[model samples]
Target: MTQRLRQCPRCGTLTPAGECCGAVLQRAKPWRMTKQLVRNLHIFAMSRKGLDAETYRLQLERVGVTTSKDLRRDAYMALMRNLRALPDSPRWKPRGKGRAVA
Candidate 1:
């Protein structure tokens, strides 16, 4: 197999195939890190629901993930953001009182 090496943009270190220098970059950008966290959370939720690989891909696609092989942090964030923006039903139970009740 041919070895593919690429220069890391931050440190200029040559990374071999199957490796990356994104960890440091991700740490530097809290928003990117948060997106990674949300992706992990989505994976965790999918696993908790006993979803298989195919089912997981389907769910990801439902949220605008075009390629299962290249799922991006932005896509995960968009999915979560859309989920959070969902409108609450008026018939739903009212939110509980705050610490004063507790």
Candidate 2:
């Protein structure tokens, strides 16, 4: 006997086992992947400023952080804190006597 496919509640379409309906699942949602990307970007930016992952991880552990999630969270928070502490924005400007026009 053949197993019947299940109907998706959101789109009323048939879906196989362990699959999701296309209409019900959005393709542009960024919440799932953005966090890791943001974390890596932050790490890369920090590295450009002379801070490496091992050093950052040691600093976090010195203050009682101990897991991958905690490390990423702390790194994100630290990056935000450093960014907020900057006196000027990190945008490019023309190399001349004229002031930067935003």
Candidate 3:
């Protein structure tokens, strides 16, 4: 049987599938990092969902997306996109207000 080698996206090292290379390369390049930062900042500012910068940072850290500045930005953008998809108005009926009468 022939075994194929998989290249690690992080370290660029080739190893058998499901094996750890023990080294992580930088995920995002410098230029990409700058661009992503700008994009994420813009999205956060425009979002009406009231994104907190500190919370977003924490979330990014939890998700293992903090390998580089660009990765952080990408995570922020993803959050903004998710928030934008929700309905703008509340769907719940008020407790006091019953059905409207004709």
Candidate 4:
């Protein structure tokens, strides 16, 4: 495996792999924890409901967002909780083995 060396633009110091050099030029991860978690929850919900665009957009509207990228951490967590409760949702109550639409 080839080791990648990162050059710090601010101080010109070469940072070793997997170490922080306290430099501002380092590339940060694009995703926050909530962002990735929300994405996963959204996928789970989609598969659980087979929701169309209109229905999905309505769900997002309840959280005051057009996209998950705009969700706050609290909202992201709350959305995950709600999605995880799909089996208990009144609108789509489970009957026998499959979900029954109300």
lDDT of each: 0.51, 0.48, 0.50, 0.60
Clash pairs (backbone) in predicted model 4: none
Best by TM-score: 4
Q: What stretches of model 2 exceed 4 Å from their correct place?
A: 1-38, 71-79, 82-102
Off by over 4 Å in 4: 1-39, 88-102
List, residue by residue over 42-98, the lDDT tens digit for candidate 2.
544343334456755554565455433454445546645654454332442325455
Model 4 agreement with the true structure over 1-87: per-residue lDDT tens digits = 855566665566666544445544554334344655666665566655656568777777777788877777666677666656556
What would the TM-score be for candidate 1 when compared with the true structure? 0.31
* Order of models, best TM-score first: 4, 1, 3, 2
Residue-pair clash count for candidate 3: 0
Model 1 residue runs over 4 Å out of place are 1-39, 66-74, 77-102
Ranking according to lDDT, highest score first: 4, 1, 3, 2
Q: Residue-pair clashes per candidate, as listed?
A: 0, 0, 0, 0
Deviation (Å) of 35 in candidate 1: 8.8
lDDT of 3 at 91: 31
User: Would you estimate the TM-scores of all the predictions?
Assistant: 0.31, 0.28, 0.30, 0.44
